[model samples]
Target chain A: MANNIYIGVDLGGTSIKVGICDENGKLLHQMEGPTESEGGPEVVIKNIANYVREIVASSSYHWDQVAGIGAGITGFLDIKEGIVKLSGNLGWHDVPVKKMLEAHLGKTVKIDNDANVAALGEAWGGAGAGIPNLVCYTLGTGVGGGIIINSQIYVGSTGVAGELGHIAIVPDLEAIVCGCGQMGCLETVSSATGIIRMAKDAVERGDKTSLALVEHIQAKEVFDAAKQGDEVALRIVNRAAFYLGKSMATLAVVLNPQRFILGGGVSKAGEILFAPAREIFKRFTPEPAQEGVDIVPATLGNDAGVIGAAGLNLHR
Target chain B: MANNIYIGVDLGGTSIKVGICDENGKLLHQMEGPTESEGGPEVVIKNIANYVREIVASSSYHWDQVAGIGAGITGFLDIKEGIVKLSGNLGWHDVPVKKMLEAHLGKTVKIDNDANVAALGEAWGGAGAGIPNLVCYTLGTGVGGGIIINSQIYVGSTGVAGELGHIAIVPDLEAIVCGCGQMGCLETVSSATGIIRMAKDAVERGDKTSLALVEHIQAKEVFDAAKQGDEVALRIVNRAAFYLGKSMATLAVVLNPQRFILGGGVSKAGEILFAPAREIFKRFTPEPAQEGVDIVPATLGNDAGVIGAAGLNLHR
Candidate 1:
C-alpha cells in the first residue's frame, strides 16, 4: 500500500499558504501564492487549488498519495456544510469553499475557522502534541481560541464553541463596548487592540508613563515599556493578563483541559504577559482543576494554520 | 436471545435507590433500601448486589437479561478505575467499587460522579433527549453541572470537565469565598445554599422584608416570599438568577450546547427563577451563539440519577 499524505491550505486575505503533511502531521513540503482576494472568492480559491497542485507536483509524492485537502479559512464558516457564511477579510459570503476546491483539485476537501484549525495544528504537531485535550489561545489583534478534545476540534452546536475572546469577563461597570457589540468582553481588554486603546486612553489622561514618549503604541511597545519598569505600561500589561488568567480559571472548571497553548504575535511578548496570567490563573482556579494543567506557548508559529488544516482530514 | 437490561444504582448517604432500564434508557422498575453506610464498603456492596438480584427476579425479565450494572456516586472518584477516591456522603475512601460489584454480580460495572450521571440521564431520557449537545445544572445545596457532547458526558482530561459550579463568575468586588476555597464562584451566588445565605443576610441586616418574619428561611421560603412581592426576597432571587444567566452566557461561547437544562429543588421555583434567568441569558449571550439555543427545566428530576447510571454502560 502507498503511504498517504494530506494537503493543507491556509487561506488569508493577501497570501494563501499551502503545505503537505505526512500521516504523522509532519510538514514535508510547503509553498505560498498571492490571494488576489479582491478578485473575489473564485480567484482566491483558484489560487489555493493551483498552489496545492504545484506543491504536490513539486514534491516527490504523487497526486494519488494525497489523501485529502483541508483549508483554514478566516471567517464565519458553516463547517458541516463546507460553506463560508461570511468572511470580512476576504470580502466573501456564502461561498461553497469545499465544493469549489474539490472541483478544482479533484480531492476530498474540508474547511474550518482559522482559530480551530490553528488549535488542531498545535494539538497534532506542536506544543500540544500527544495531549488529547487542550485549548489554544491566539493572542494577536484579537484574542482567538480553539478547544481541542480527544485530539479533535470541538465545534459546538453552532460552530461557535471556542469563542474565548467574546467571554464576558470584564464587569459591566469597567467594560467598554466590543466590536461584537458586547460590553466587557475578554477581547475588549485582552486583545492587542485593547491594550493599545488602554495605552492611548492613559496618555490622553496625562498619566506618567514612558509610553507617552513613543510615537506609535503597539502591544510590543507596551511590553517593552513594561520590561523597562514603566508603571503605566506595567499596569496595562497586568490588566490584560488579569482578564486572560481569569478567563482561563473559568475554562479550568468548565473544560479542565490538560494544557493551555498560547500562540500568535501577542503571545510573543513572552514572560512579561505569561507571568501575570499564570499567577492569576493559579489564584482563581481551584486546586484539582489546576493540578496537572499547565500554560505554555505555541511552538509552530506561523505554520500552525496549514498544519492544522492538513490534520482536519485525519482528526475531524 | 433475551433482550438485555441494565441496573442503575444511585448511592446516597441515607439510602440506596436502584432501577432497571432497557437499552433505550427507560426506567422499567425501581426500588430503594437503607444504605447503612456505617456498615462500610462491604455491606454497601452486598446491599447493591442483593437489590440488583431482587429487582431482576421481581421483574418479568430473567437474570440472564442483565447486561451490566452502573453506579452514580456523589464524591471524588477515579472513574476509569471505578474507585471511590473520597466520597464525603458515603464516608468512603479508595473503595474499588467496580471490582467489588463485579465480584458479586459477575458482570461489567462502571461508576461516575453524581452530577455527570444526572446530566447523562437528562440527555438520554429526559429534557435533552435526542439532543447531541447540552449542559445540565442541578441547583441543589450546591450547584452541580454536567456537559453532554455528541450524546455522551464530556468528562475533561482529569474527569473534572463539567464542574460548572466552580466557575469564578462573580466579580472580585462583590465576591465571597466558596466552599472549594475559590472566591466569587457561581455556586457562591446561584446555588440554593447561596440563595438561603443571601436571604439570611438580608434579614440579619434588618432589611424590611417578610423573610425576616419567618423563623427559619429555606431556599423555598425565599422563593415563596419573592413570589408574593417581597422586595428583599426578590432581590436575592434575581441575584441568584443573574449569576446563573451570566454563567450560561459564558458557557454559550465556550461549549455552545444547544440546550441548558436546570433541575433540582431550586429550579422548581418555576417562572420566577426561569423567567429572570432566560432574560439574562438572552441579554448576555451573543446572537449567533444564542440562536436556536433554549433553556428549559430538566424533566427527569430525581430519577435522572438512576437512569443516567444505567446509561453509563452504553454512553461511556
Candidate 2:
C-alpha cells in the first residue's frame, strides 16, 4: 500500500507554514500564508484553517493519502486536549486549536509546543536525524531547547519539557531578570538578544571598539563586526559563545546528548561561534561527558520548524 | 507461575549493598557486605560474588529462582561493553566490572552509573514508584541527579543522562570549584560540603547565629540552628534553598518531571530544607511547569540505591 501523507502545520506569530510530508518525513509539497495574527485568535485561526485547506488543494497530492495533521504551534499547548492552553505569540488563550482545525478540516489533529516541534524536526530529519536521544538548543532571542528520547519528544508530566532558556544559569536575583520574570536565567548571557544587550552595555560605557561605529546594533551586527575584526564585537561574540558553551556543556553533563545542534539565525556564523563554544564546553564538561559528545551545527536550518512539524505525522 | 527473583548489586566506594528483588521490585531478602574497596577492584569484585551467592543460598530461594544480576557501580559505565569507564571516587579506570562479575557469579551482569541506579530505585520502588517521569537529586557530599522518563531511565546518546549535579547554577568560574574539578557547579551550593562551606564563611565573617556554638559547623548543625531561628543559619539555609530551588526549577523546566525527589543525608532536614526550596522553585518555574509539578521528599531514603539497582532487571 502507498504510504500515508501527513500535514505538518507550523503556526507562527506572523506566518503559518504548512507542508505535506510522507511517513518518512519527505516534504512532497509546501505552502505558506500570513497568520493575520493581529486580528486576534478568531481571524488567525481562520487563516490557519484556510492555510491547511489551500495546502491540500494546491498541492499535487491527494487528501486520501494523508494520515493525520500534526501542528507545531508557538504557545502553551494542552497536548492531551489538543488545545492552545495559552499562546502569547498568536494572541490566543485557551483556544482549542487542534479540535477547531480538526473539526473544520474533518481529520485528526495533534498540537505541541513550537520549540518541541523544532526539536522533533531536528530529531527526525536534521542533525538529530539518526539519533533517537538528543536535545536541540535554538540560540535566537532566547535559548530554546527540545528533548527527544526513544524517538519521541518528552513533554514532561504536564506537557512542558525542554524549556532550557528559562533555567536560572545565574543565581544573582538582584542583578538581572529573565523574560520569564525570573532572575539570572541562562538566556541573560547566552541568547542573541542577551548577546546584543551585553555588547550594547559595553559600547554605551564608552569602550573603544568597532561596535561603537554602529547607530543601532543588533546581535548579527556584533557577529558581522566580529568577522571584520572588531575587538568589542569579538568580545561580545566570544562572551555569548562562552555562556552558550557553558550552557551546552552543563546540558551535556546532565542530558549527555551525543550531539549538541545549534540552530536559529546566530548559528549561521558557523565555525566562529562553534569554535569558541567547543573550547569552553570542553573546559566545563567532565571527562566522560566530553569524551563521546560532538558539538554539531543544525542541518535543517530555518526550515527545521516546518519540517519538524511535518515529522509529527509519522508518530501519530 | 511465581515471578523469578532478580539480584541487585550496589557497588559504592565504601560499601557493597545487594538485594534479591522480585519482578514487582519487592526485596525478598537483602544483605550488606564490606567492599573493602581500598582492597582493590579484584577484592571488591570477589566480595560482590560471595555476597550474592551468600544471599541466594541463605534465603531458601534457589539460584534458579534468581534471574540475572543488575549492578549499579560507582563509575562511568560503557553500557555496551559493561565496562567501568572511570570512577573518581573508587580510583577505577577501564575496569571490566561486568566480565569479572559474570565469570565469578556464573550469570549475566548489567552495569550502570550508581546515580542511574538510584533513579531506577526511585522509579521502581521508592519516591518515584509508579511514576512515569521524575528527576531524583541526591544531595550527598556533592549533588547528583538522574532523569527517568516512562519508567525507563534515559541514558542519553552517550549514557550520561541525569548527571544534574554538574549543571552550572553558579555563573562565575572561580566562585567554587566542584570536586568533579569544574567551577561553580550546582553541587557547589547545594551539596553537604558546600552547605558547610557557606556556614563557615558566615561564621568567619562574624555573623551572629546559634550555629556558631557548634565546633565543626556541619550542614545538619546549620539546619538545626536554622530550625531554631538562628539568623546566620537561616540565612545560609535559605541561600542554599535558593540555589537548590533554582536548580530544581531549571531542571523542572527542561525535564518537566512529575516529581523532584530530594534524597541523601542532607535531605533529612525535612521541611526545614524542602519548604524554602519549594517556595523558590514555585517562584522560579514558569506556568504549566509549576502547575501540578511536585517537589517532594525522597521516600526510599538510603535503600534507594539498592532498590534502584534492582530496577535494572526490569529496565533491560
Candidate 3:
C-alpha cells in the first residue's frame, strides 16, 4: 500500500509535537521534542524534519505511505507559500516553513494558523465533524476563531480571515481597549484575560463576595464561585457571557455556521458560560438565522492542532 | 446555437425592474413596470414571469437562449427552495417564486436577498468584478450588507448570512434601537436615517449650522452642509463615518475582503463620508488585515439588484 499516512506538526514555542494520521483523519502515532529556538530558524526547521522522520520511521507505515506534511503555526503567515510572517511565541519572522520541510523530506507541505488548524481538526474529527460550515473559538488567554466554509478554511483575501474575537460588540461608554488596539472587541470582555480582569476588578472594588477570600484568583476560581452562586462572581460571569452571546448573535448573521465549537481553558467553565451566552444569542439573533445553529464544546483538546495540521492536505 | 442569456428581476414594493445578461455579464436589454402588489402575491408572481418572458421575446435572444432566471427580493426567504418567506415590500409570505417561475418559463431559477444580489452583481460585473472575495454595503434608509467568498454568496446556514448593517459597532451609551429591533447596531448610526436623525437633532438642539436654515432637512442637506463647513453637520457626518469605518474594521478582520463596495444614496456624499471611514478602518484594523484592502463606491447604482439577481444562476 502507498504510504497513505500524513505527518502533522504543531509548532509551539516550547515544544514541537508531530503526529501521523491515516487517510481517515485518525491520529495513529505521535511524538514530541523541544523546539530549541535559541538555535535559530535553521535548527528549529531541522528539529521538525527530524521529528517527522522519526515518527514515520518508528511507525508501521513506510515512507512511501506518507502522503504529505502539514504544520500548524501561531501568528501571521502567508498560508499559500507556507511562510511564517510573524509568530510572537516562536520569535520567528518570514520563516519559509513549507519550502524547508519539502526540501528536507521531499513531500508536499501545507501550513495554516494554529487557530485555523484547530478548527479544521474539530470539523474533521471532533464536535463539528461532517458539518460543511462551522466556526471554532479558542477561549484561552485570548479569544481566537476559525471559520470553515464548504469544509475549507475561509482564509480571506489577506489570508487572515476569522479573527472573530476582534469583532466589536461593546457599546462605547462601557468599551475597553482590546490588545489588538481596537475598542470593545469581544476578546476584551470574553477571553480568559478579560474574565480574570473582571474578577480582579470586583475584588479591588471590595465587593462582598466569596471570591474576595481566595488567595490567588483565576478563571477557574471565578467559574467555581459563579457555580456556587456567589453574587459578584455571577455578575462577572454574566457580563462575559453577555458579550460572548452578543458576538455570537453578530456572527450568526455574518457566517451562519451550522455549529459553533467552543474550546480552550475558559470554555471549561461549562454551562455557567454557555447558558447565558446561548440565551443572549437567541435574544439578539433573528429567528431565521438562529434556526439549526448550535453552540457546543470542542472534543480534541491539545491534539486538535496536530490532527488539523495533518488534515490540511485533505481539507485545505 | 445555444442560449447563454440569463434573465434578472429586481422586485421592489413600487416597481419591478428586469434585464437580460450574456455569460460575460453584459446587460443586453432592460425594462421596468409597476409591481401592483395590491393585486397580491399571485399577481406579483405572474407579473414577474410575464415581464421575463416579454423581455426575452423582445430581445435579440430567443426563449431557448434564456439559460436561467434570477430574482432579487427584499426581506426573509427560503433561498434553497426559491420561497419568499416574508417580504414587507411585496406583501408576500411563503411565495414559491422559483417553483412558479420555473414552472412558467421551463428554466432553472435562483433567488437571493436584494442586498446579496446587489453584492453579487458588483462582484460579477461592477466594482468588485474579478475579485474573488469582497463585501458590499448598501447605505440606504437602513444599512444592508452582502458577503462574497470565492465568487459565491456566503448565505450562512439559514440563508441569512451577510447582515453587516446589524453588526453592533456603537457603544451602549450612544446606541439607539435599530429597525431590526437590536440596540446599537451599525445601522442606527451609519445609514441615511442615522445621518438625517443626527442633523435633525443638531437643528432641534438650536446648534449653529447651515442645516438649521433649511426648511426640511435630509441626508443630502446634511452632507452638503458638512461640505460647506457647517460644524454641526460635520459632527453628524463624522459620527456616521466613524461607525461605518469601525464596522468595516471589524469585518476586515473577520472576512479580510480585497475590496469593500459602498452603494446607495447616502454613499454619494463621497469623500466627506469615505475619507473618515477609511481613516478609521486603517486605525482599527491590524496591519496584516489592512494590507491591500480598498474601500470604494459601488458602480452599478439602480441596476445592481437586477444585474446581481441575473448573476445568481451563474455565481450562486
Best candidate per DockQ, number? Answer: 1
Per-residue CA lDDT of model 1 for B44-73, tens digit only, reads 999999999999999999988888899999
Flag regions of model 2 displaced more than 4 Å: A1-4, A13-15, A22-24, A34-65, A88-93, A100-108, A171-174, A195-216, A229-235, B12-15, B34-67, B86-95, B99-108, B197-218, B225-235
Kindly list the per-residue Cα lDDT of model 2 for residues B1-316, writing each as its tens digit: 5568889988877888899887777777889988887888899899999999999998878887767898887766798689988887788989998899999988878888878888788778877778898888888888878888888887887787788888766767345778888777778888889899999888788888766778987888989998888888888788778788987887888888888888888999999899999999988887767877888878887777777777786785
Q: How do these models rank on TM-score, best leading?
A: 1, 3, 2
User: Each model's number of backbone clashes?
Assistant: 0, 2, 6
Error of 3 at B32 (Å): 2.2
> Residue B20 deviation, candidate 2, in Å?
2.9
Best by TM-score: 1
lDDT of 2 at B101: 90
Ranking by lDDT: 1, 3, 2
Q: Comparing to the true complex, what docking class would candidate 2 get?
A: medium
Model 3 spans > 4 angstroms off: A1-4, A22-24, A57-65, A200-216, A228-231, B1-3, B34-46, B62-65, B198-216
What C-alpha lDDT, on a 0 to 100 scale, does residue B199 get in candidate 3?
Answer: 84
Clashing pairs in model 3? A3-A64, A3-A65, A171-B171, A171-B172, A172-B171, B3-B65
User: Order of candidates by DockQ, top first?
Assistant: 1, 2, 3
Question: Candidate 3 has what TM-score?
Answer: 0.91
